[model samples]
Target chain A: MRGKHIKTVMVGGIFLCATPIMAAEGKLLATAGLSQLEGSGGGGLVPWATLAGYDSRDETTALLFMTDVNITDYRLSSIGVATSFYDRVELSYAQQTFGLPVGLVKQLSVGEIKQNVIGAKVRLYGDVVYSTYPQLSIGLQHKQLDDDSVATALGAKDDSGTDFYVAATKVHLGAVAGYNLVWNVTARATKANEMGLLGYGGPDNNGYQMMMEVSVGLLLSPNWVVGMEYRQKPNNLSSVKEDDWTDLFVSYMPNKNINFTAAYADLGTVATQKDQKGVYLSMTGYLW
Target chain B: MVNHLKTALLMMSVLLVACATPTKTPISLYEEIGGQPTIEAITDNFIDEISFNKDIYRYFEKTNITRFREKFIEHLCVDTGGPCTYTGDTMLKVHQGQKITETDFNLTVDLLVNAMKKAGLTYVQQNRVLKVLAPMRGEMLYK
Candidate 1:
């Protein structure tokens, strides 16, 4: 019962993809100062997906970096950066760390579940300077799992692998209000045993699995942004497993050098469990 | 060798013809623009376009438009070789911390062209204005 409920929540997790906000809907949302937190094939947080907003810059090329944290019993964190060339083409990279503090992740523990992701993105349409077409981009993410010690500890085959995803993004222009949307589909080698940790779950055959995500954001002011995201993952990998989370967040940018964010997240449990909820406060710094 | 000599004579004849031609009176594009009167006429149109506009300098009103109009014409005429003197300070000195953005600048460009139209300037005359002011982009932007 708990596993099914968690699975249901996964669909909503798509909107909770990336919550880096501040100015997401405006003449500026499409043309923010830096894309460190925004600008993708889809909204922020969709791995290897494209976005609606093109790289809209007119002066010396632009660069941006952002980091978000989820505060709860199970620690999770995400960091990202995006840079544009000639205001048309763009490139980005990100890393996500889940199950932080490892609880008891002794380097000796075999088959310990840890997920690290690296990604790149490119913008292919809509001129950053003057164009009527909605800006578009494409992306790819490489998800890697370290399973050496964990393999021996579990007496099973190593559970490390990768996941691929594609996405699209769009921005709506208006006289009073602005909005942005991003969506994507993820493909994986197998279901059940992928990025989740067994150290956290008692006896679930959780393995590398496939999933999908969709994220969106709205700008309330020139300097403030609010957003929500939800993700769906495979939960049938084992007898004891749960999936899905919903995230609501807000971000503020005082200048080109810094962005501050706060968020509320819902992390479902693995075995006969309850919804694990928490808040995260994080600060991001940009170099160059 | 005879053919080569004939070719050299032909080339020299063309060169001599080109050099002997007298230089026509060079007309200063600024003077052809009708000097201060031309700038003043365009300034009036730009003021109407910008003063009534809500995007840039929306805070200024009809009276403010007249005052700014007078100042701008004086400035443009002086800068473009018209017989006018401008006492205004530097552009950066005037717009410091005004929060002026590129959107506002583009809109101003639209208004300027609209004003020139009202002043009966032809496309060539309009381009003459831009050819001078466009190069000042570095001085007018960023701050």
Candidate 2:
């Protein structure tokens, strides 16, 4: 069933990519970062406040993105769509599938974990570029795990929950040796375990915990960016110790309507699995 | 590591000596952006862009293009620390009856950025010029 859903989403993505192309209007090129895993505008792993796409207050911008991750013992894929309105408000939705190794699937009596996420973000103050102040935004994500039987067996307390975060992003043009620099800091209050794939909360801790995430990117040119991100997670589940996640990524925007990103991610451990390092690839298409 | 440290110390001493030598003159923003010729070229491109942009051209319809261009060039030249005098009207005075919206102001800025790009200014130079101009948005908008 999960495989079928993944295939359907992939087909939908391809269809969207084939839609009639229109020139992206407003703001300069590459000001809006690529969509992150959770469908927010950001780097691969961390969310930034800048809206996706270059459209400003006069226009609306839409984006479709698909990401695939190959880990040592597992595979994860996410398909998402996001829209930015007037460069001030954003709405996004994403579906994620976590595939376990065949041996682990048999041992745990679980085939795969599927999750759906809906997110909304509002720009509160400042501008990401062309201003000295750091742009601030507040975002909320509602996650629901489709298969909670494995999560319950692993001592998860809930199958669904909401995560709230406040993010600040600032861009410094020509800050470092003629290269632009972008800095982001986010604080999240979440109860999700492993981004809610294993479910929300647990036996050890059922309350929401605050987490910190930071990311920095250097613009190698107007079209290329290299960055690193660190996201801290809570160890709420006693059954499995959760560690922080980090990634180093490079993104290239060849034009206004398309961009590609590749990254090396260290997801730490999941369940009993250790050293879950992996490679990630994502492609994004923009529509105006 | 030791070689790196020695290199760092040597560079620090060289910088210190350079700083102690007081005869070096500070370059103004105007000089850094080239002189009258570069500023004039940028102004011409900016005017061309504004004229072509339907969103902003309507605002300039009743005004004198040639005179406005000269005033704008003079304004930029003086604002960038050049040896030119700006005898134009104050920002608030000139834009008082226009009642420009934020969107209009931002559109103008975008056009200006494009003009700078067309004038062959680097991103750093463009940003430096924008820093001096962005603050005027408050005076130019909603009045």
Candidate 3:
């Protein structure tokens, strides 16, 4: 009976967490970047050093996000939530679904791939807006794939693994004709192929490889941002050639609690699909 | 070869002329923010806003508004590279016994941002001033 009650409470908690609640009123405007695809506070494709939400040093902020990407040959969808405490540390969770064509699915013996990502980030030093030094953060993501059989067929050695990264972000006020510019650089160590949709640690090499990611944003106004991102990936699977990803995006905040983003993404190639380019859209709601 | 030589000579002359031309020095933050009169007006408006704010108003209950206004204007002017000197106490010295918290500090900044907006300061100008003031949070809070 006790176990049944606990299970019921857990199910209720998931539903309650999806609703947006009113947050504290004192956070600075647009200090937090938009939610990345993996649920971190960042651009569309890459994570930045900024924490999620507008909460200042003394408050806590919560964020919920949903995103969809439609490429020429595939579709990716994600839903996640994140929280930042005292503007110092962040915790996030996301569930991703990758869908492919029926022919490709048959070839790979899989219809779709599903993943769950648990992420944590800690601010180390500096302020992106008010300091001369760039804000620096260290983050980790532990990803678990749902289907181990498909991963095994693709020469994957592990179904779950952790990615470690360090990111630096800086905001330059009045950088170009009085507009603010935000720049970020991140170094990641990971063994995940295509962010673990194809699983981790291929047969050729079951070791982590270092990769670089970069994002730059221009503040067109206090509530609008235009940005671009580039992310380099490692070639873990010899059968498939992995290429870099790039995107151009625009984000708008209607108020402190709501934000929307749209982008054009060039994923290069995934699996056997070539020139896998498409549209990406995301919406996020903030709570305190 | 002769045409290439002529192009090279023309390019060299243009480069030399560009190098010889005098460049104008950029204006300082004080002048860019409209100098003394504008700053004084902003300070007065900011003081009014702060005086009405419930969060930090208790700290200013016994203060002198006129002197505080003058000191604030002077402080901002000197901080922004204007030809003025601040005669008030340092941030740490003044807030040493105030027992200010981070919430108090943030509220004060919020009021200041609102006042700057009300006074018609552009976003860039307001951020420039806020950047200079933001670092003072360390010295003024809980000290």
Judging by lDDT against the true structure, name the best candidate: 2
Pick by TM-score: 1 or 2, better one: 2
| Residue-pair clashes per candidate | 40, 0, 0
Alpha-carbon runs more than 4 Å astray in model 3: A1-22, B1-25
Candidate 3 C-alpha lDDT tens digits along A57-97:
77888878878899999988887889988878989999888
True contacts kept of each: 0.00, 0.13, 0.21
Query: In model 2, which runs have C-alpha deviations exceeding 4 angstroms?
Result: A1-24, B1-26, B97-104
Ranking by DockQ: 3, 2, 1
- State which candidate, 1 or 2, has the greater DockQ: 2
Candidate 2 lDDT, A1-288, residue by residue in tens: 546655765665565457767745566556788888888888787778887767766678898888888888999888889998888999999988899999879878888888999989998988787666898999998999998987887788999999999999987655554356777888999999999888899988999999888777777776888877778888878888887887778999876777889999888788779889999988888866
TM-score for candidate 3: 0.85
The digit string of per-residue lDDT tens for model 1 on A98-210 reads 45334345444421244444545565664222334444544544444554444334333444333444443443321111122222233323332324333211234335445
How high is each candidate's TM-score?
0.47, 0.85, 0.85
What is the lDDT, from 0 to 100, of the residue B27 in candidate 3? 88
For model 1, residues B1-143, the per-residue Cα lDDT tens digits are: 23323433454354344435543426554576776677788887787777688866553533455567778887787666677677776767655656565545545765786788788775555545654565454455547
* Clashing pairs for predicted structure model 2, backbone only: none
Q: Model 2: how far is A20 from its true place, Å?
A: 6.9
